[model samples]
Target: MSIAKRLASQTAIYGVSSIVGRVLNTLLVPLYTSRFVAAEYGIVTGLFAYVSFLNVLFTYGMETTYFRFANRPGTDRPELYNRVMTLLLLTSALFTAGLALLARPLMSLLALPPGHERYAVWIAFILGLDAVAAIPFARLRLENKARRFAVIRFANILMNVGLNLFFIVFCPDILSGKYLAGLRPLVEQLYDPSIGVGYVFLSNLAASAFTLVLLAPELLAVRFRLNLEPLRPLLRYAYPIMLMGLAGMVNETLDRILLPRWLPEGFYPGRSNLAAVGIYGACYKISILMNLVIQAFRYAAEPFFFAQSNEKNSPHTFALVLKWFTLCCAMLFVGVSINVELVARVFLQRPEYLEGLSVVPVLLLAQLFLGVYWNLSVWFKLTDKAYYGAYIGVAGAVLTIVLNFLLIPIIGYMGSALATLACYFMMAAICWWLGDRHFPVPYPVARLLIWLLVAVGVVAVSWWAPIGEGWGRYGFHALLTLGFVGLVAAVEGRRLKAL
Candidate 1:
């Protein structure tokens, strides 16, 4: 099979776990938006942003390090695995304990409600569970255990969504005598309305712990040992990776972290900073269609890139990945942006959340640019020039931080969205410029940019010439989307089929 086809098939399997499972979990947006006030949901959004940053710290890029060394000549795979797992176990414990011990202070720092320190403790455990699971999950990808990975990951999402429903949706309803009133007495023992939005944290904690339990077979299979001889080289490689990861996350999540801090009071008239965050977070979900694609592609690409590193055609293969990835994202951007209103109304639940829909297309395109950067970054990863990746990431993060600080005060969340778009675009451009100098790839950049420009033009037309509402408006949008698709096929069909 062609390299692209093999990777595409693997992506399809992983997509079931990522794309399908995340879509299921994302479907809970309506439930959360309905049950909690915007400010309450903002707490969820903000804390989870920190969770992203903390997760990168806790794992510290060790999973990729494990992949790098485990496949080396003359290496003992089990011993290497044991060392990585032992280190992860020890550090994860310390990190979780530290957070639990300082939950109250951390809660205060986060600006969470007094007495909501339990949220910090819950997040700590969730972070630890996720950190500990990193190596085993990466090993599954390396070993081509995609189906097992998919099943376990899918089950985790199911458990999370189910618990969310039981707590947030069903329990509240029963207690309110909305339905199943007879079960109110039973639920009172299990549910506490006073906890309120705290159930979201508890549900996630349970799901994360449940996932660890499910991975017990993988964990148990590792021979117990604490060998540290392999530790030096691994850390040497991983430090840059950790730096890159942390910076990449800054580009992705710093907006969430800073929006509330920098957004001026009374900026949105009736809206508080937290309310604006809640609205932005909810609107961000509209971009998940693109995020889902990037995620599945990453899960598949990382391993594939490593395995194909020795092939003579590796650079060309990487270029194809970028071209196709950009094409898919461009098509997605136009299709979704033109029909964003219908999409927003379906998932957002509340009219208040709909106000931030303007950011959706920008965020979607930003994610696309980030994915392009991911593809361009293969040169650094393959050449063992990982520090260069860190440099690029730090550059992007600095731009992200600067842009958010400058923009949020002036234009609200829209500034945050624009910052994200500009940050990723700059990162991609820098990576490509460096890649061309250090390790050139024959990416069809001109054709790729043309596709994106065409997509934006079509979306603009939809905005300028609305065909009213109802089936007519939607039909017009659908036709526009299909026309974009046909244009892509006409231009790229022969090359695509060759792949």
Candidate 2:
């Protein structure tokens, strides 16, 4: 099979797990919004936002480091893998113990409500488990274990979803009932009717614990060792990537943390701060379709790019890949923008949440730019100038912090969305400019710009078109999607066929 075909197949398998898992996860939004108050869900949002940053800290860029070192011709791949796994195990253990010790003060610092410290502890555990699991997951990718990777990932997600439903849906009924009469008093003492939002974190903690059990195979396959000789070079390579990952997470999540602080005092009354955050988070989930695609592409693209480094036609391949990425992301922007009104309903159970609908396009396009920036970043990665990624990511983070500070005070959450879009655009433009100087590729710039313009035009038209609510809106979007796909096919059909 051609590289493109192989990539296509790998991406499809990865996408099935990622996109399908996310879609199933999306259903939790309605379940959450229905049962929990918006502010309560805001806690869920804030806590997870914190988890996102911690996840980056814990993984510390080892995935990319593994990819870089594991591909070296003289390397002992198994030894390298075991060394990294050992490092992760030690770090994860320390992290868990430290967090457990400091959970109360940490909770207080994050401004959790009274008696919510346990939630923070649970979240810390979740992140620690995920950190420990990172090496095993990366090993799956390293070994081209895409099928096993997908299955394990799918099973983990299913476990999360099932446990979530039990905690949020089934457990409530069981608790409310006078079951066996002996259990009623115990249940009443343990279960709080007002703890509606706490279940989100609790369920996640449970699922994380369950996932550790499933990773037993990946853990037992490799001997544990940490060799410092290889670690020196790996650390040098990984440190910049670590900075890049940390900055990247900040770019993605800092808004949720900052918005509550910067919003006008009493913006929405007592719970509205959290409610607004919850609404924003729900709308963001609708855009995960674009995120999943970009992610799947990266999973295939990185290893493929590294393996082809010495090929004479590698630059050409990278250039072609860049064009396809831009085209697909642009098409996704148009498709999601057109159909978002319908998509919003899937996540928001109440009309009040629909207030966040406008933020969806901004968030979606921000993610698209993010994907483009990532695709264009291969130059630095392959050449081991990963520091440049750090530079670009830091620049983006500064932009994010400044813009969010300025705008959140004025426009509330929408300002955060706009700030994110601007930040990602800046990063993409900067990365492309820098990458050309180091590793030039003859990207199809003119064609890519044409497609972007077409997307803009399509979005404008779709907005003005009087598509009624419900099925009519979806139908209109479906038609627009078809039109965009047709244009792409017509323009790129021959190129694809030749490949």
Pick by TM-score: which candidate is best? Answer: 1
* lDDT score, candidate 1, position 115: 88
Candidate 1, which segments miss by more than 4 Å at Cα? none
TM-scores for candidates 1 onward, in order: 0.98, 0.93
Clashes (backbone N, CA, C under 3 Å), per candidate, total 0, 0
Against the true structure, candidate 1 reaches a TM-score of 0.98
Candidate 1 residue lDDT tens string, 9-97: 99999999999999998898988898878898898898888889999989998988898887677989878888889899999999999
Error of 1 at 233 (Å): 0.4
Model 2, span 1-499: residue lDDT tens: 9878987888888876787876787688888877776777777888788888878888888889999999989999889888988888888888877877887886665567678877877877888888888778877887888888778777877888887886677667777663455665666676666656667777777777777787798888778787788688888998899999989988999998887778887775554676788878778777777898888788777788888888999889988888878888888898888877777667778776777888888888899889889988999999999999999999999999999999998888999999999999899989989988999987776778778878878987888877677777777779988999898999888987887
Worst 10 residues of 2 by lDDT: 178-187
lDDT of 1 at 74: 90
lDDT of model 2 at residue 440? 90
